[model samples]
Target: MNRVLAFDLAPKKDYIEYINRGREERIGTMKVSDDYVRQCEKAKEIQGLWNPDVGDWIYSYGSRSIEKVFGEVTMRYTKVWLPVQEDLQAILRYETPLVMLQAFNDWLYTDSGYGCVNGARFHSMQELWLAFVMWERFSKVWDGKDWKVV
Candidate 1:
C-alpha cells in the first residue's frame, strides 16, 4: 500500500471503529460523503474487477454495498461529517493512524481476506496495525470508470 500522509500519531477515535460501532449499535449516525462512499465502494470485494455485467452476476459484496451500508443514515448524520480532504488529515488524527490506514488499504484489495485482524475482534494493537493497510493505492475519483490515475 502507498503511504499518502505520514503522521507520528492518530486521534482517540479512529473513523473505522466509529463506523463499525454505528453499525453494531444501529445508531444510523455514521454518515460519510460521496467520496467516502466511493472509497467504501472500492473497499468491497467485487466479483469481477474488469468484466462488464453478465447473467446473474455483477460487482457486489453480498450486502456490503455502499447503498446498503449507508441506507439508514439520513441528513442528520450527514451534517456531522468532518469532510476528509484530499490529504486525509481528518483520518490521520486517530490514535493509531498507521493501523487505521493499513486496515483500510487491505480492505480495498478484493483478494485480501479480512485484512490483518481477520476475525470480528481486535485482540491486540498488533492486529489493528496488521489490518491498517486497506486504504493505500486508493484514488479520489472511483466511479467504476476513472480511478485516481497518475
Candidate 2:
C-alpha cells in the first residue's frame, strides 16, 4: 500500500488573501527583471518537466517545470506532498483517492473539486494537528486489516 501525506501551514484562502494583498510586489521589489527572467529560464532546464506535447501551454509554463523537477526527487516514494496552494487542486484532478486537508476559511478550496476521497477541514492549527492524528490512527487501523490504500 502506498500512503501519501501532504500538508500546508495555512489553507488556500490565506494564500489568496496574501496574494491579493500585494505580497508578490513585496517579493518583486527585491528581484531584478533580468534576474527573475534567468530564474524562469532555469526552471525550464529539465526534460518532460511539463507535458512536452502541450509545448508552451503547460499550466505553469516555465514555473511548473521547476516544481516538477523537485517532484522527481520524490518519485520513488509512491506518494507526493503538495502542501502548496493551487497545485493541490491540479494534483487531485489528475490523481484519485486524494487526501485533502482544507480550511473552512480558505478561499482556494471549494467543495466542488473534491471528488471521491477523504477530506478534512480545519479552523486552526490545533484542528489540523487533530486531523493528522486521526489520519494516522485510521491508516494504522486500515493497515492492520490488510486493506489496500493508494
Candidate 3:
C-alpha cells in the first residue's frame, strides 16, 4: 500500500496564532470571516471535511502517533517529508532522503533547517502545486518504473 504522511515544523508561536485564528472564526455566535471561510474551504479540498470535533481531536492527539509511524516507515522508504527540524535532522543523521516542505510565506519553519537534507529546499507554490510536484516525482520511483528504489 502507498502511504503518505505530513507534519508541520511551525514554531509554537505560529501554531498558536493559527489556532487562535481558528478559535476566533468559530467563537461566540459570530459568523466566520470570508477569508477564514476561504481558508477552510481550501483545507477541506485537501483533507476533506471530517467533523469539527473529530478534526480537533486529531490535531490534539494525532501528531505524536503520526510521528511514531513516520519513524517506523523511515527505515523502509527513501523519500520522506518531515515537519519538525529535530525529526528531520534525526532522519538525515541516518542518511535518509528527506524533503523539507516549507510554506513560501510562512514565518515559522522558514529558517529552521534549510541545509539539513542532501537535496532539500523550500516549496514556494500554492498547496495544489506543491502536492502535484511532490507526487509527480514520488510516483516515478515509488511505482518502480522510471527510477530505482533505494
Pick the TM-score winner.
1
Q: Compared to the true structure, candidate 1 yields what TM-score?
A: 0.20
lDDT (Cα) of model 3: 0.25
Ranking by TM-score: 1, 3, 2
Q: Candidate 3 on 1-150: residue-level lDDT in tens?
A: 333333364433222111222232322122233232232233322223221221121122213111212112222222122122232123223333334333212323233222223113322222223223223333211111222222
CA lDDT, every model vs. true structure: 0.31, 0.25, 0.25
Clash number for each model = 21, 1, 0
lDDT of 1 at 39: 41
RMSD of 1: 18.0
Candidate 1, run of 10 with poorest lDDT: 50-59
What would the per-residue lDDT of candidate 1 be over residues 7-64, giving only the tens digit for each residue?
A: 2224422122122211222112333333344343344322112222111111133322
TM-score of 2: 0.17
Deviating ranges (above 4 Å) for candidate 3? 1-26, 29-31, 45-49, 52-150
